[model samples]
Target chain A: MILTVTPNPALDLTWHVEALSPGATHRVPTAAARAGGKGLNVARVLHGAGHEVLALATTGGATGAEFTAELAASGVPHRLLAVRAPTRRSAAIVDDRRGETVVLNELGGPLAAEESTALHDSAVQLARDAGVVAICGSLPPGFGAEHLGELVAAIAASGVPVVADTSGPALLAAARAGAHVVKPNREELEQATGRAEPLAGARALLDLGAHLIVVSLGTEGLLVVGRSGAPVHARLPEPLHGNATGAGDAAVAAIAAALATGVDLAADTDAAARARLDLARRATAWSASAVLMPLAGELSPRHAELEAAVVATPIHEESR
Target chain B: MILTVTPNPALDLTWHVEALSPGATHRVPTAAARAGGKGLNVARVLHGAGHEVLALATTGGATGAEFTAELAASGVPHRLLAVRAPTRRSAAIVDDRRGETVVLNELGGPLAAEESTALHDSAVQLARDAGVVAICGSLPPGFGAEHLGELVAAIAASGVPVVADTSGPALLAAARAGAHVVKPNREELEQATGRAEPLAGARALLDLGAHLIVVSLGTEGLLVVGRSGAPVHARLPEPLHGNATGAGDAAVAAIAAALATGVDLAADTDAAARARLDLARRATAWSASAVLMPLAGELSPRHAELEAAVVATPIHEESR
Candidate 1:
């Protein structure tokens, strides 16, 4: 089973309005709420594709209860550690008239030291039994980069490959902790490494000890790079136009699913290179397929056709 | 004792951000949630003033639990009847940079038939013990104007004065059911009676059997009209510039508090006229004082000073 950990999960609330005016009052007839976080989204995508997956997160208060209840109702297997502070909420106001969404995310409240330690211990224990583990999303307040580094190191030491999808110092922490793979979108890569070019940013992570780096380039698809191999750039012929909120999580799910299938990436051989290329192609296709779906946790059923349409080409190291 | 009924109560959530831009993601460091509704605000105002008050409303689901928990934490005496659907939420996004707030209100989900009957029965029974009963805010989905009318009629028949603060057809229904007083803001009055002028709109409610029509005119203060004699206009010498969100509810609280003290308005005598004027002056002052406060359900401590500054003048019927 694939294990996913979201340090700061949220109860996502979405409201659709005809138009969004800066200072006007709006009446929303109905609203939708569900459990959300990058790691949870990764688990959902894998589960929807008939893969065995388990989502782990910290929750508290009434909002946390609602979040856990929604996950149970959705039938996604999950184990949540109780914390002291209430789970934060991320409200997305979708403007029907403007065809765009504005999101207001609450930075989660501080987690107690004991709560953080409990989560770290739980993630390590769960990772031992899982085929692959993915640590995702932003860390909650008081959950420092050192904590993320220690958790990733413990999970990686458990003999299971750990993948991390986070931003800022946490991204570097996961990489330095020897995560097998790390995924960060274009903007996040820049924010973490201060590198405008994806290749340079991927190199920075590789220099920190990450085995492989997968960068999601939005409509441009995925870029896969390693410490010493020809980087692969995978993209579909035409960009798909739809919601892109869950694309990176879908990419992470694809990478985790591929790694769980016993692909040996430690050896320097032609077979290993081909396996890495195949992984890159699958991730790009899955990420693109996610754009066609409306909600974050959902994936389009046309993933096979999308996989076939992806073009993976090796790029010269000196290009950037 | 005063009873305040909020048919469609909300868990009010407020978030502050630097600025609101369409299609942009914002990070809210913290957020605040509390029990809110027109009637609940009225009850809060009364309770804050050291008056005996009970707030009543229907609640369901986890959000409802949070609402009740917050009220309990605040030490507000309340009774919440359980319903099937979750209580609605009103989110206010305060733009710190722009110095404005945008509100997104969710109209509550449909209430079960049995739940509606239970609320109706409970409100009427509670009204019997209350010195003054105030029915406030909008009715939930499936709880029609007819339900409001029936509830008001039953409460009025119990010999307790009923004050209603609602808009649209519900206001007319409350008036026709012999509500002792009705408070509607300027825009609500125009929408209900299709009269741009408050005098004409107040006259329409009077013709429908309402004993008093109190129109909240925002910065301009209040216009109080009865079925006979001269209408009274009351205003503070200077407008208090602050949040006016809970101003109308504070006015209703003042009117209810005044009536609870055994001010008889049944006779068209000189004493009754003076009592009506006093009620108008108090309502105006209390409302202005509420504007000076930051949050809803809060009143400024300068209410007494505001009351002394209020000017109540008899308006000639021929002037309309």
Candidate 2:
């Protein structure tokens, strides 16, 4: 089983309108609301793929109740911790005429000290029997990067591999805490390491004690790097276009699914190298498949065909 | 006591941002949520002025919980009927850089047949002891204009005068049901009566069995017509420029407040004419004062000064 922790979750609302006009009143013809956050998306992808996964997050207030009810309706296995502050909401307005989407995200309120401590303790305990743990999303107010570092260290100490999917200072903290794998998209990697080159950014995470660094390059595909051996790259023959909001989360789900088999990449053997290549191919295909779906936390049924079309290669020489 | 009924109440959320760029994601720095609807705003204005008032509306689902909690915190006396459908929400994005506001309103879900019947029965019973009753706002899905007409007729049957502030066909429905006073903005009046002139529109409403017709003309002040006597016109010495969203509701509040004194305009006596002039002056002043307020359900403290600046006159000749 895999355990997923979402520090900040949202009741995501989407409104469909004819078109968007700034400073004008719009009557939405259709609207939908669901439970959303990076970790929850990851858990949903895994669960849909017939994997056993448990989603953990903190919920409170009226919006929190709505979020919990939505998650339950989705039939996703989950446990929620109660807090005092109301959950934040994110709204997206999809304009059909112009084919544009405008989003508004609320900054979540501060978490109590005890609530943060309780979340950390709960996550560590839940990871005891899991083969791998995935910690995803932004750090909420009052939750410093150091808290994420401590949680990552504690979960890794329990002999379960931890995958950190975050950005900025939190990404560095997770790497320094000895997380087994860290995934950062191209823009996030640049923001965290201040390095325009993806390889240089991946090397920065490796130097911080991370066993593997996977960088998502959008249409360019996936790049995997480690302390030893040449970095691997994977991509499909053509680019797919649809909704790209959940592509990264689906990629992270593929990585977690691969690691749940108790495969140890630190062994540096032929089997480890082959497993790394498989992870890259699967991640690229899953991400592309997600782009074909209209909403997040869903994948196209042609994932196997997409994986078969992927071409993964090892970079023995430096390349841009 | 005055009773206000809002058939389609909303939990209004406001988000403040520096600027708005279509198709871009905005991180709202500040946000606020409160219970809002036309009738509720009227009740709030009356309550703020030390008048005994009760607000009645329907609430359900998560958004309803938040609305109920906020109404409780506001200290406004209210009784809400629960339904299966979630309450609707309206969001406004205030862009400081552009000095503009963008609004998105959700059409409330359908009310169950039993729920609608229950609300009508409850309102009629509650209005039994009220000096005047005010019905405001749009009809929710599954609720037709005939329902509003019936509700108004039922409340008025209990000997409580009904002041209706609504739009479209609902405005005509209320007038046809013998509403004591019906207030509609110039645009709404034109839409409901299919008349280009405000006086003609007011006459149309009066022909439908309404006792009084008050048409708000934005910066042009108000045009009031009734079953007897010449039409009255009221305006401030100078037009005040500010938020005008709640100005009409404030006008309705003033009318309800004046009627709560048990003054009978149907008597057609000299004292009754004097009371109509007073009502016109107060309504114009209160409506202008509301323009200075940033949010609905609030009146400026300078209402007395504004009232002193109003000039009201009776029109004996036909005018546009």
Candidate 3:
């Protein structure tokens, strides 16, 4: 089974408003709550693609219980290590009229030292038997870049490949620790290298011990960079709109799954890129259908298409 | 004893951000959650003033459990009627620099038929034993205007005066049921009477069987109207610059406490008005201090002074 670790998961609460006028009262038209975090999103999309995925994370208090319940309802298997503080809730107020979204993200609760050690131990134990272990998202308060680096080293020692998707100091640490795959968006690459040009930054990340680097460019497509091969480019079929919340996670899920299942690095890169574009298309369609149907039922068709598309792509990369 | 009922209480979550720009990600500087609702606020404030107050409301699920825990932690006596659906949460993003607030309010979960009946029964029992009972805030989705009318009538039958603080159709129903007191802000009064002049609309409400009508005019203060008496006017000592989220509830709290303790009604009217102003002042100070300190530890020293000032003012109608 593929294992995914989300260090700081969240309960994402979304409220729909007609328009957001500052300092003015708004009556919400609708509201929804879902389990969220980059790793959790990857697990969910992978589950939709018919993969046996286990999600591991540290959870706390009432919000954590709610998050677990939502994950269970979504049919994604999860193991939660209980903690003392409540899990953070991130709020998104979507104004459909002008397509504006405002996110109010809470600084996640602090984790105890023992809890952090327990999480690293769990990751090591799970990585021992897993094909590929994906560690993603932000570190909770109290756990720093070195903590993530230690976890990457632990998993790497277990002889299993690890895929790391994060930003800032944590991403820098993961690259330095020799993560097999690193997926960072264009801005993240620029920030990581302090370079305006993403091509150079992607190569820089690969040189920093990342076996492969995938740089996502919002609607344009993705760029794949490796140490000994020419970079391959994959362009999405169509321009998409709506929330860009989970698009990167979808890409990570596809890449990790393909790599674990013996797909060649370059071919898997192309498949993963296509999978994200497909997910984006589905996510937009799902949001539109949510207007006329319950949101829960609107995305199944698109999810099925994404699942099928990822499976059809050949595993071996062919020279262009 | 004074009783306050919140049919749809919430766990109020406020995210403090330096600035909120739409279609962009923001990192909140701080986040706080508290038990909140009109009646709950009234009960808490009254309890702080050394009054015997009972808080009654519907609660369910994990959020409800947390709400109850918070109330207990604050030393407020409460009786929560369990409902089938989880209580909703109201989130606000406060922009400190611009003094702007964005509210995303959720429609609270609907009450089952048994839960509604149980709430009415609880209200009747509390009304029979308490000196004054205040029914506060909006009805949850499952309740109609007639539910407020029925609740008012039941409380009135016990010879305990009912104070209704609400707006729209619920205000109309409460008025028709002959509530002892009804407080409506200027805009709500306009909506109820379809008249731009709030005083005229307030008088019309008084004629509809409401024994007393108080119209809140934002920072200008309050206007009290009754049958066979000249309208009484009370203004704040100073203009308030903060958002008036719970000023109306504070007024209800002061009125209920004064009436229960046998303070003169006229005197209490002025006292209630002043207390409302005081609550506004304290709330502002508390919010600003909360930006720097823990919210519970941020109660302003001015609170006691404001309370004492309100107690000193006895309401006396000039024409009465």
Candidate 4:
């Protein structure tokens, strides 16, 4: 079983607008709400891929209750550590005409010290029971990188492989605490490595005691670096376009699933990379299908066809 | 006492971002959540002016509860009709660099028949006890213009003057029901009267059985029409830069306050118009002041200054 921990979760509200004119009023044609958090999205994608996954997160107030209800409705198993303040909401305004998307995120309120302890306790318990644990997303206010780093250390102490997916200081702290895998996108990788090249960034993270490093390159594909072996590259054939809101989470989900199922580390990295590419393609198709249907549960056959085309390729040193 | 009714109020969430590039992720620097709805805004402005005001609106679900809590925190006197379904939320992403405000509003779910009846019953009770009642804002989903029209008629039947502020079919329906006053902006006026001229539009509503008509001309001023008078034009000095969101509501609030204080109809129109401009100016000042001091009380001084500048001017002839 794969366990995912989201420190700060949100109810993502998306509004579809024709064209966005600044300072001008535009009526929204459609709106949708989904339970969102990096870890929650990872768990959702894992579950969608027929994996056993449990989502653990800290939630509070009315929005928290709504988030829990939405997760239940989506059939995603989750345990919420209730706090005093409300969980923040994130907004995504999709301007279809210009193909632009603007995201507005709230800096969630601080959590109590007791709540932080409770979250750590929950993560420990879940990590002990699961084969792989992924801690993802931004830490809420009042939770410093050191605090999150401690949680990552505690999970690693349980002998479960830990995947830490986050950015900024938290990512730095988690790497110092020795996470098994750290997934950072290209920009984040640059910040982590202080280098523009993917190889240099991946090497920097691995040097920080991360056993493996996966750097997401958006449309460019994924870069993998390991301690014992030379770096491997997994390339996708097509560039996928869509919201890309949950694409990183999908990639983490694939990695967690592959690791738990005993796929070889290099093979798993390749598989995870391809899975992300495929998911991106599928996501784009699903989004297009939604334009025509505007409702869930009505994906076009093209979505499945795109998913089928994703092939995991392992690049060994000899091949390189 | 002046009463304001908002059948479907919302928690207006505004996210201020540097620049919004749609389809790209952005981190918001500032976020604010306030109780919103046309009637609620009117009530807030009235309360700010030290008027005896009671805000009545529906509250339901978690968001509604939060909305009510926020109102309480802000010291706004309100009576919310609790409903089963959650109240809706609207997100506005303001890009200060581009001066664009993109709004995504939820299609607020409809109230049940019983809920609708309860709202009407509450409005009737409030109207019976109040000197003036204003029914404002767009009707929530599942409610037709006729429902609002009937509600206005019910309030008017209580012998208290009823002011209906709305647009589109709802305005026509309310006017046909013989509302004491109808306020429509230029666009709404054009839609209602099929004329671009404010005078023509105000006169059309008067012919449709409205006893008094207030046509808001945004920056120019207001055009007031009554049975005994030809038309009254009230002008306002151009306000400094500010968000004009609640300006119209502030105008309604001022009108109700002036009318309750026994001001003549023409005088009331001019007072309201000037008050609106003042409100716009102060609201802008407050927004800027809020950046330095995040205290709600800090806005009081500006509010008072704006109130002092509110001058009512009567117009004997309409400006071409």
Best by TM-score: 1
Question: Which digits, one per residue and each the tens of the lDDT, describe model 3 over residues A1-320?
Answer: 88999998888777877778888777775467778777887788778767888999878887888888888898898888898778888777777776666776677888899988888999989888788889998888877789999999888777777889998888888888888788888888889788787668877887777777777766555666666545555543554555556667766776677667754453346565454444333433332222222222123445444333321122234632
Q: Write one digit per residue (lDDT tens) for candidate 4, span A1-320.
A: 89999898887777777787767666664357777878887887677667898999877776777787788899988888888878888777766777556666777878888888888888898787899999998888767798888988888877788888999888888888888788898998788668898877777777777877777666665666666544555544675544556656666775686568654453345565454444334433333332233222233345455445543344455432
Stretches of candidate 2 off by over 4 Å are A29-31, A196-199, A216-244, A263-285, A288-294, A302-320, B29-31, B196-199, B217-247, B263-294, B302-320
Candidates, ranked, TM-score: 1, 2, 4, 3
Question: Candidate 3 on B1-320: residue-level lDDT in tens?
Answer: 89998998888777777877877778674467778877887787678767898999988887888787888888888888888888788776777777566776677888878788888888998777799998998889777689989999888877788889888999999999988878888899999878787668877887887877777666656666665434555554654554456666666765676567653343336564544444333433332322232222122345445433321222454442
lDDT of 2 by residue, B265-302 (tens): 54467887888888889999999988787677899999
| Worst-scoring 10-residue span by lDDT in model 2 chain B | B22-31
Winner on lDDT between 1 and 4 is 1
In order of lDDT, best first, we have: 1, 2, 3, 4
Off by over 4 Å in 3: A232-238, A264-320, B263-300, B303-320
Native-vs-model 3 lDDT? 0.72
Single out the weakest 10-residue window by summed lDDT for candidate 1 chain B: B262-271
Worst 10 residues of 4 chain A by lDDT: A289-298
Model 1 lDDT on a 0 to 1 scale: 0.88
- State model 2's lDDT: 0.87
What does candidate 2's lDDT look like per residue over A1-320, in tens digits? 99999998877777777877876677764357788888999999999999999999999888899999999999999989999988888777767677556777787877899999999999999999789999998878877789999999999987899999999999999999999999999999999999999999999998997899999988888998877777899999898765567789999999999899889865588888888889899999999998777667888999999999999999897554
lDDT of 1 by residue, B1-320 (tens): 99999999999888888888877778887578889988889999999999999999988888899998999998889999989899899888877777567888898988889988989989988887899999999889778899999999999998899999999999999999999999999899999999999999998998897888999998899998887668899998888776566889999999899889978664488988988899889999899888777678889999999999999999985565
lDDT of 4 by residue, B1-320 (tens): 89898877877777777777756677764457777787887787677767888999887776787788788987878889888777887666666676445665666778898888888888888787799898888788656688888888887776777788898999998898888778888899999789887877888887887877877666555666676534555543444344446656655665676567654453346555454343333433332322222222123345445434534355566453
Candidate scoring better on DockQ of 2 and 4: 2
At residue B318, candidate 2 shows an lDDT of: 56
Task: Pull out the clashing pairs in model 1.
Answer: none
Worst 10 residues of 4 chain B by lDDT: B289-298
- Full-model lDDT for every candidate: 0.88, 0.87, 0.72, 0.70
